[model samples]
Every structure is written in structure tokens, then in C-alpha cells.
Target chain A: MEVAHADDVELAHRIAAGDEAAAEEVVRSLGREMFGFARRMLSDSGAAEDAMQETLLAILKGASKFDGRVPLRAWGFGILRHKITDTLRKRGREAVIGDVDPERDAFNAKGAWKHMNFAPWREDEETLQVVRDCMETLPLRQREALELFAVEGKDGVEAAALLGVTPVNLRQILHRGRSAVRKCADAKLGSDED
Target chain B: MDDRIRARCDCFYQVLSDYIDGELSEEEAGLVREHLLLCPPCLVYLEQFRIVHQACGKVESDDLPADFDVVMQGVMTAWRKDRCGDPEPGS
Candidate 1:
């Protein structure tokens, strides 16, 4: 297998050799990020913990067979993504309460901006809170897209694959999510520009 | 915005993420690039998009649950038992 990171490949080998230290290293390196990702992906604390545990177990079990086509971190994320999806499935679909289509509201039927004007963002703690609140309110798919692309730092192709959407679809989701958050923040925080 | 500028901005909006992601073809990206130079509204939107992107990245991470280590230990113990028929390596 074509390993992306040499140290990761070494770690894989150590893990395959039943090195507990290597396993602990993996946990230390990836645990917080995994928990954080799960927390954001699942609203319930117990569900997030369950997903994180499942992902870590899956990683330890699969380490012997690690092919290293991607970095160890990305591999762990893929497993975590699967766990999150499974958890979401078991939870069934969340309620569609007050689901407004921002795209329709923002763009005209002909695709021109209906509201072209925007106040420059006033970056502050309040702005961050507004963005977080807006993100939480977004539809699951759009939130996941933003999480993977913006927060998790996955590229378009990788995020698209994780979300099981085409690149075009991923972009659409990201754009709409961004627009909604921007609109929300602008409304709440007003213009930094005087 | 003028009708012509609005028309161009419409095209740009559809591909905003793609443009930011560098996924657009060079020709398409160049067109958007040229449009941003003359279009204040679209330029503001682009900058705003970037700000939001940065803000998203700044969302604080919550600490792991208190029982995280215990749960992980439980998993590793179970896995060890499954692999070696014992909870501990030798026992």
C-alpha cells in the first residue's frame, strides 16, 4: 500500500505487532479530535461518546490491516464518519422544524441575488456564537458538509465521498450553509465596517 | 447592481464554493476573478464567505466526556479478550 505518512506506516506496523504503546499513542493523538467531531455530529452526549468509542475500537481492530493509502488521521476520520452515520441512522431522521430554504430566499428564480447587499462581518465572540448557532440549525446534510469541509479540513473530493454526495452537490450544500450562516451573523453582529 | 453586473454575479454565486475551493477550471476561475475586480457586492460576498469559513473553523471543541478513558479501556479489554481469550495479555 502507498503510505502517505512514513511515521503512520511505522505506527501501523507497531500496532500490528501488538504494541500497546502504539495503540496508546494513536488514542492520544486522535482521541480529542474524534470526540470533538462526534460531539458536533451528534447532539446527544451519550450518542457522541458511543460513536467515539466505536470509532476507536474500530481503528484498533483494523490497524493490523492498515494499508496506509491515506494518512492515519484521515483513516480514523473515515471510521468515525461511518460510526456517526450509523448513529444518525439509528436515531432516525431529525424533525424538520422551521426548515427554511435559504437558497430560495437569497437567490431569484433566475439565480440572481435577491438580496445582494451585506454588512461586513464584525468578528468577535458573539459572531462565533452566532455562526455556531446557525450551524447547529442547518439541515443535517449541510451541517455535515460544513463540518467536513470547513471544520475538519477535508477537501472537496474527500468530503464529498464521506458525505456520499457528488462534488457538485457538496459545493451546493457548502454554499447554502455558508450563505445562511453569513446572513445570520450579519444580522446578529452587524457591520464591522463603519 | 447593474443588470449586467447582476447577471455576472448570478453566475458567480452558483459556483462560489467551487471557486473558493479551487475546483473550478482555470477559465471559469479567471472569469470570476475578473468579475470580482469590478463588482463590489460580489467582492464583499466573497470576503464574507471567507470570514464565515474562518469562523466555522474557530468553533470551540468540547472536552471529551469524563468516562472516556474507562469506555476506551472497556473496548480494548473486550478486543483483547476476543483476540487472545483473556482480558489481560498474559492472564
Candidate 2:
């Protein structure tokens, strides 16, 4: 994400002033993205919506708390992340840390390919969509890591923190997740005769 | 490939994810680039890595409620209520 500028700062000020229009604007602008984030974390539409409502409520109530130390959007995600954590905790669920070993999956002790059987993926939109589909086919543990780090562009440290792993462990999870999804997508596309 | 080179390739390929994300040190990335020039498999892997990066960097989001505005209005009402006893905001 690019750095936000003065406009967002102004928006924060307006919202803090208790302007209803400003509150609505913030909800409309970030609500969808936050919804997407909530959905990814919870994977339940009703729970996601509940979390989103709570996030929006937090934004409105906490607008005065935004000190402008970070980009407004970044601060917004921080709140959303907290809301997601609260929702997960209330449900008695924890974010599972994936232990996929890319090195073991892709290479033998000799550093060569092992158990790989697929053609290269075509660089088209359709193939990319298939890549996303293959991403969904992965176990939720790996999928969540890829979704947070790669797809959502979250900070590795934050992602690792959410999953309760160190940064190095998170990178290994991302590598193994990417390798599995890439291979699965390649095979699915190569066999499609399209 | 010699044992030393092969060992280096293995090490380099293992963390290519970090390399692709620009997480590696300059010297580590430089070493990987040098290995890429000598290894066809690693080169292909790099290309696929590009594809994965491109594909993952953008994704479509689903699962938004149809009545988002309505729900948000309800949330705003409660927010307005909490800050003050005023039933209507901007009063």
C-alpha cells in the first residue's frame, strides 16, 4: 500500500469533529476492504459482517484516538486487525500457524526437483484466476498465510505476529504455500486442454 | 553441478520467497542472481515465481453484505448515542 497523505489526515480530523458525513464516508470507503479482510480471517459471512460492524463502530468511537503518527488507512487496519482478533477469540478459535516445508516439498537432499509434474503456468488472467482457485484448494493453514502476506500485502511481522510465529518461520510457510499453490495451479491448467 | 555449487543452489532456492519479497540482504540476493545465471531450473523457478507474485498481488474480494449502508447507518446511530444522549447527531 502506498503512503496516505494529508487528505486522510483531514478526514481523520473531520471524523473526530463528530461530523456524521465524515463518518459515513470513512465507513463507505474502507468498509469493503475491511470486509474482505474480515472475511479472509473468519471465513464466515455472518461473523465477518459482525466483525465489520464492530470495526466501523470502533472507527467512529476511536476517531479521536488517531494521533496521525501513521497513515490513516494503516491505523484503520490496525483497528480492524484488533476487531478480528476479538472475534476469533470470542469464538474460541486461534489462527493456526502453518508448518509447510518448501525445501522438503520441492527438493530432495540433492537440491533437485522432486515429485513435481506440471507445465509452466500461462501468464493470463484466466490462469491467474486458476491460481487463486488453487490457492483456495490449499489447507486453510497455508492459505491464510498466503492470503495475509501475499494477497493482502500485510507486513510480514504483523502477519507473523497474528499467527504466533517468528518472521523466518512465516517466510517458510509462505514459500511452501506458494510452491504448493503454483504447482497445483500449473497442473490444473496444463491438463485443461484450453 | 559440483557438490559445493549444488549445495549453494539448494540454499539459494530455499529462501527465494524472501529474495522475491526483497527481504534478503543485498549480498544474499546477489549470490542468488549469480546462481540463477548458471542454473536453468532455478531460472524457470524464478519465472514461475514472477507469475505467482503477479497473480497474488491482486485478488478479487467477495462476500459483502448487500445492505451495507443500512447496517452502517445502524452502527452510526449507536455511535452517536454513545458519545451523547442526543438521539440525532449534528443537533
Candidate 3:
């Protein structure tokens, strides 16, 4: 999935010129990544599919206006961000405004490990199941941040750009996400020790 | 540890992902580096974080479904057809 910059730029040029072949190439190249992002953002398969379609349509309509300053994938992701936001807005849904509670403050002060024991994760089926279960329990925004930055290996700034959030906010999301995942891992791995 | 230094250590860990990814400003990075040198706990935390980070990547990227490419192709075909009917404006 290492798409070279030159290739993306050339494909983007063709797409801007209304080349159907290039459009197909663009979709083929970016579809899964975009779908994965949308799925995590919405946490609903149907909504993700709809959002992906809208994003693709926006790419088709807006291709000609692209200035080519940013990487094509980055621009495409930016378009997807807007499409997802619009879809969410239309559904009358809003992102949760997380509060900083005493528990969070304590966790922050004492270090997350103080509240939980850490054990090495095994590669057994049970271990994998626990990991999956923990991942599913994360809030949508935190999960999206983890998937985009950690799983997809996108840089924080690029991920922030794609999510349409400030880098500071993105950092907060990653921090919270990793902490939650660590807590889950700790709980699951520690159970075997008892 | 001084309370002030401990607070900075917590902030450093909170932003450790950013730090590892080179997202911080030079000044911020220098501050974190200084803190890491003096703080053994935060240093251990960073090491453990890296392990989890690498492990997650290994687990998630394994075993692509055989039909992944096919599924993408199907989606691409439909997407292309949706944009195909527009006559070149000058034509």
C-alpha cells in the first residue's frame, strides 16, 4: 500500500481531466483505507458505506479544483472528512464532549499503571479475543485516532488533517485512546495471574 | 520527584505519541528529552508504550481477506461509472 507521490499526482491529473480510468484507479487505490476510516468514525457499517459514496462523489466533482499543493491522498482524505462531517450533521448526531473527572485526574496524577497491573500478552485465541473486545469498547473518536495514527501508521499531523482537528486535540485523543487500550490489556492479561 | 517535574513528566507521557512521531516543536522536544533523562518511570513507560504500539500493528495488519482487491475493484467500477456520463464540456 505504498503509493508513491508521483503516481498519486499523475493519477490526480488524469482524474481532473475527466479520465474514467484514472477515477477507477483512484477508487481502487484509496477505497479500503477510506472505508476503514469511515467505519471507525461512524461505528456503523451502513453509515460508513454511505459516507464513502459521498466522499467518492465529492472527489469526482472537486478534482478539477485541486491545487496539487498537498499530497493527493491527503486531499482525498480531507474531502472524506468533510463528507463524514456532513453525513453526521444530517443525522443530527454530534461528537461527545468528554469531561475531565476526578477519576481521570487521579489516573493522570498516579500514572495509569498504578491502578492496574501489566502482564505480557500471549498470542493465544483467548488473548486475541480479549484484544478485539477491548478495541470495540473504545469511544468512536478515540478508536478513530488509534486506527488512523497507530494502525494505519499515518503521522499525527496528517491524521489530524484528515480528521479536521487540531494536532493538540489529536494528541489528546491518542493519549486517551492508548491509555484505555492499556487498561483493557492490563485487565485481560492480569486475569490469568490470579 | 518535584511536583513540578512530575507534572511535566505526565504531560510528556500524554504527548509521548506525538513526541515519538516527531510532531513536537524543537523546544517541546528538548523539554521532553530532559525530563526523560531524569525520570526513570516515564522512560519505562515510553518503552512499554512502544512495545504495545508495535504489537498492535503486527496484530492488525495480518491476514488480509482474499477478496479485498476484488471488493475494491467492484467499488471502483461503480464509482467510475457514476462519473462517466459527463460529456467533456467542450465536446
Candidate 4:
């Protein structure tokens, strides 16, 4: 989530200069996140591995074009995004599904939340565990959307860019993820209380 | 709740998320803020939603391969060989 812009620029310049150690350091720093990103985006672990390799190879091959203006992570993420997109395309549509009805709420037609009480609660270990569980219940695309936006702390535009969706589409997907998970958590917790 | 009052809170519930993310304009944000001053339930919902998001941010990362160096070396070696071939091809 945090990018050291100045350090990134320096790293990019060094990599562009064909500094092997600098390239290694770049891999050390950004490789894990890029791997995780690809893993989350691709359904196949093998495909994820291929995407990660392609991402690194592309970075090194294209390092000369690194002008240091963009943060190194941004450039790296862009490459990874492209690699993932190509993998998805070559493999033919890798399961982009979504489902959510915002109207399925406890709110009455009068616009009042009837029968649902969203009481303010502090964050506890139990709540965190439940949230984690709820995340597993989301559809693939919705879950990815939420992870990038909510978990990775990327803004709508950045998350959309990573997911290859429009910003408006990202918002809708995020909203669906949030509402679906929130409602599920409520139901789960409510049943537990019962 | 009265119809107008209920409708306003409904709007707040829907857009409170945009408010949380600072997506709402100054005017829309102001209206939501003003509404929150009176609606306790929405304040609760907002807090709950925020906590859910925060907990998600804290979700433990999946286990990555212990040695990324191996993978890096493989790609770097291939990359060098590929780059060694053929001139820059006049971009």
C-alpha cells in the first residue's frame, strides 16, 4: 500500500542501468506482492506462476524504458496487470461472475430498516474472524474487487485499473461485495447469538 | 420514522459508503454529515461497515513461496538471453 516514491525512482534508474543487484533487490521488494496479485487474479496456481515469471521477465527486458517518473511499483503493477490480462484471454475468460441484489434488505418500503438492527460494535477478534469467513463466500470477481479496493487499500481508479474494469464498474462491484459480506456477517452473527 | 426522514436516512445508508471513501462532493458530504447528526442507526451501520473493511485489511496474507530468488533467477537468465539476441529493433 505504501510506495517509497523517491526510493522507487532510484531503484528504477539502477535497474535501467542494468545493475544486477538492483534488479535482484527490485525482485525482492515487489515480487511477493506481484505474485500475490497474480495469484488472486488467476484461478489456476500454475497460471499464476506463469504470470509472475512473465511479469519479472518483462520488467527486466523493458527496464531501459523505465524513466523513473512513475513509482516503480506502479510500473511493476501495470506490467503484472497486462500479464494477467493476457493469460486470462489466452486461457479464454477466466470466470468473471457477479451476483448481488441491493434491494434484498430488511428495510421496508417506507425506507426504514425494519427487523434489522445494525448496532455499532467495536472491532474484536471475533468480528475479524467472521469478516474473513464472509470473504470466502463472495463470488470470484466480487471477492477480487473487494480485496483490491478494501484490503489492498487501492482507490477506485487504481483497483479498477488492476482489475481491468471501468471505475464505475469497480464501484458497483465493491458495493456488491461489501453489502453481500456485511449482510452475511449479520446473519451469521445473529444466528450465533440465537 | 416519518416518510421524508426515513427517505433521507435511506439515502445516507446508500451513500454513506461513498462518504467513507471521500467520493462524495462537498455538498453531498455535508448533507450526509448533517443527517448523521440525527440518525443513530446510520452512525452504527457506518461504524460496522468501517470495522468490516478494517478487519479485512488486517486479514492474514496467504503463504507465498519461501524462496522467490529461485524464480527471479530463472526469469532473469531467460531475459538476458532474449535481450542478448537482436538489436533494439529501432523502437
Q: Pick the candidate with the highest TM-score.
A: 1
lDDT by residue (tens digit), candidate 2, A24-110: 888888777777767766767778788888888888888877766666666776777777767776777555544655446566776
| Candidate 3 per-residue C-alpha lDDT over A45-129 given as tens digits, one digit per residue, 9 for 90 to 100 | 6677667666776676677766666677788877776677677667675544333321255344445334333345555666655
Pairwise TM-score winner, candidates 3 and 4: 4
TM-score order, best first, reads 1, 4, 2, 3
The estimated TM-scores of all candidates read 0.68, 0.65, 0.62, 0.65
DockQ per candidate: 0.47, 0.42, 0.23, 0.38
Pairs of colliding residues, candidate 1: none
Task: Provide the lDDT at A160 for model 1.
Answer: 77
Q: What share of the true interface contacts does each candidate keep?
A: 0.63, 0.51, 0.21, 0.55
Identify the CAPRI category of the predicted complex in candidate 2: acceptable
Q: Compose the digit string of candidate 4's lDDT tens values, residues A1-194.
A: 34346676677667777677887887777677777767756745567777888888778778767665556666777787667767766766454567654535757776667754665454688876787688766766777777677545646676786667898888777776777777778777767773
CA lDDT for candidate 3: 0.63
**How does candidate 4 score on lDDT?**
0.69
- The order by descending DockQ is 1, 2, 4, 3
CAPRI class of candidate 4:
acceptable
Instruction: Give residue A38's error in model 1 in angstroms.
Output: 0.9
Q: Kindly report the root-mean-square deviation of model 1 from the true structure over all alpha carbons.
A: 5.5
lDDT string, candidate 4, B1-91, tens digits = 2234334656666675577778877877777777777777777777777876675564256566666667767776776568566323332
